[model samples]
Target: MNNMRISPAVISKLCCLPAFYFFMFCSLAAYGDDSALNIELKLLQVLNLDAENDQQKMLGISSIRFLPSADPSKGNLILLSDDTGAVENAYGIFETPHTFDVAIECNNHVDGEVCQYEENYTRDDLHYPPLFTEAGLNQDQIDSNNLWCSMFYVGSFFIDSSPVCESDIEGIELLSGGQERLVMEEQVVGFTFSTPAVLHLDAQNFVTHKYTFPFSIFGFKRNWSNQNTQKTGVRPNGGFEGIALLPGEEGLYAAVTEFPLMQDAHLNRFVLFSLEESGNRMEDKVMIREHYSYNVDKVLPEGAAVVKPGYPKTGVSDILAVHNKRRSFITIERTAIRYINRSISSVNKLFLINLPDSSDQFSSSELPTMSVIKKEIPIDSDVMNNYNIEGLTWGPELAGGNKTLIMVNDNDAGRASQLTKIFIFEVVNL
Candidate 1:
């Protein structure tokens, strides 16, 4: 202490060094401990089985919606299966290097001697279920009718015989329009009938309506009536392939894909409908209407559907709408191949489309200018070839103005795998 003294500037400079070191250590700690920064994508959950033992398969998950839960940190996830049923067992249970077969038989004819024949059909061959039909039938009859109707239309088994061992009249009554009448005529002799075998005469029971079938034989006539109702709005004639919850409205938007398999050629657009909430329960209102049209072919990747010609080249596979800081909506378009195995080999595309204010109308013109977010994203992987990306929604918010996006794959196609994967991605600047 030989009268040595430091100036204020020197003292200040010396104080800054430790502060800098402290900040550096803190930053390093955050960088090391924070999981959101290191990886762009993370696997959250894998839902393989539902309550009924139906394993999630290829294109199994068509839509996803996030419902507000009591805990702000968590949300109830509602998943819509593209089609509810077992994955089409194309190959035998013991077959290796599993492959899809339109029709497979266990035994073959050897030297003109008939052997045991075990036939296996793919889901594609036995189309899932029609999106629209008369209701009121029990679940068993509904399923039988769905199978017979699919067989009648897809397999060209237009005869009156039921593919399933059930009453043909039960399935015939479920059909709509002339098909119902045509099928019923085969069962009813000496009777001339009109379309709409089951006619909705009244609208008192909005949830469930009454359908009447009029018949006459030998100057005797009577009105046969049946009750039919829809659970969630009018069952979409087209498959419910995509859904987006309205940010600040009492409704959600849904999309019906334009593939030939759905058999709904007229519905190639998005629909906006309100949801009726009763305490903890929610049901769709019967007031859904067209919202917008997003053509899939406009952004179809080249050579995408070459492997599966039957699959639609372009269709809206999934949709997610969120509001930007400007109070305008931005939609994420997830387009994918429609086939099961082919979708694995094909690449899916995602686009960002800006929407007008929620009060304003949506136009197809906005689609042409939509910006591409990620192009050429493969639905399949080296480990899993039948993974088809379908469901997408906004996940929990992340730090640094970044948002998280969650997507799920439908894995029930070529292989009978029970694993359905959920992927999380961090959305950075545009």
Candidate 2:
């Protein structure tokens, strides 16, 4: 029998070899499989819809949806318009502060017509004045304040234009026509509210609908009035900033940022509603409400004053609910002041939130709290510098079972930068 003795140096090298091999194996496995860390973003297209005049700049796209077309190879983009300024009044009197829908075709071709307009729905054709008046708003006041309903944003499935659950089942007819045609359900839905005034639009038309309820709906002791003061404890200005329809569920979730004027308010609230259809209007019944207090100071830049005396630190820019999953992705856009020169800079971060499983009943008193998973996705500085990125939606499916994320910015009014940019990135793991 022969006994072999290896030197200490040789033994150590052999031991290190196994560890190195294991590390490489794990790395290779992750690269091959669907892993979050391995997720890669690919910029596919940058559709520019800007024109020579201010009226033609398609920059104020606050909400976007990648609608499935008859041809699977091609996809349609539906954008909901909103104001870029803090107040809609920034658009001069001659420039009507109206919101509309613009549908464009996005194909594999990278030609000039790759993003040509397919259809246009003007505010006149989509605005429903009665929806506000029906909510106890005085028509005279609405007109006096120049408070016209404008679509702030939109949310829906990637393939379907409507919510996962038919809003009509809740006894609300969303279409101006009849519910006999289910195809109308696929129409783009928008949300409008009293912006810069306080009242929030919870939901809007199938493509743009704003639903308002008394503060009491959320267990608050305030009535809907035009006081423009927080003494009512009622949020009059911040309404439906972001929206996401729950996948494979009968629920619709929306986010409303607390008015910057509210002294004691630091939390942004998410309201859950049951989507129902009412004639020409999508009716949303408030189910439950949950609030999240974001750490603005941690997310903001140096010398930033997120919690100002009368300004909101962060706003819910956009929200997207992943397909066939109970997860919601939210983007928060924060404004900060630079320490050295007091210059203002914008910061954007994405939050992946886990939603509760669907149940037959939801109680307002005990709403489920959404927990954030990942919050490190940063918006490109160039995009933030030139435009306010407010619109976000799930893009079409990509090769290798990956997904796409589409973001659009709202270019400020009267800017000579007639370049509306669309950022497209493929989601590898998500």
lDDT of 1 by residue, 1-430 (tens): 1222334355334322432122110000111122111112322223333223222232344444443234323343434332322222323221101111111111133453211211231222122233235244455654554442221111212224432211111111111211111111111111122111111111110112212121111011212222322111111222234434445553343333333211123234344543333232112122443344434434344453454554434444555564442212223333344444434443443443333334444322222232222121112122222356665766544434455566566554334344555544445532
lDDT of each: 0.31, 0.40
Q: Clashes per prediction?
A: 4, 31
Which is the leading candidate under TM-score?
A: 2
Q: Give the per-residue lDDT of model 2 (tens digit) for 1-430.
A: 3323444355334322332122110010111124222223445566566555555555445566666545433465656554422223224522322334445444444463333453343341122242344244467654433333333222212112211111100001111112211101111122122221111221333223434333333313323454644342324434445555556554455444423213224544444454343464434323344443333224434444444443324555666666644544445454533333333455554444443334543433222343222233233233334356666776655444566677776655434343556766655544
Name the top lDDT candidate. Answer: 2
Span of ten consecutive residues with least summed lDDT in model 2:
165-174
User: What is the alpha-carbon RMSD of candidate 2 to the true structure?
Assistant: 12.7
- Alpha carbon deviation, residue 150, candidate 2 (Å): 16
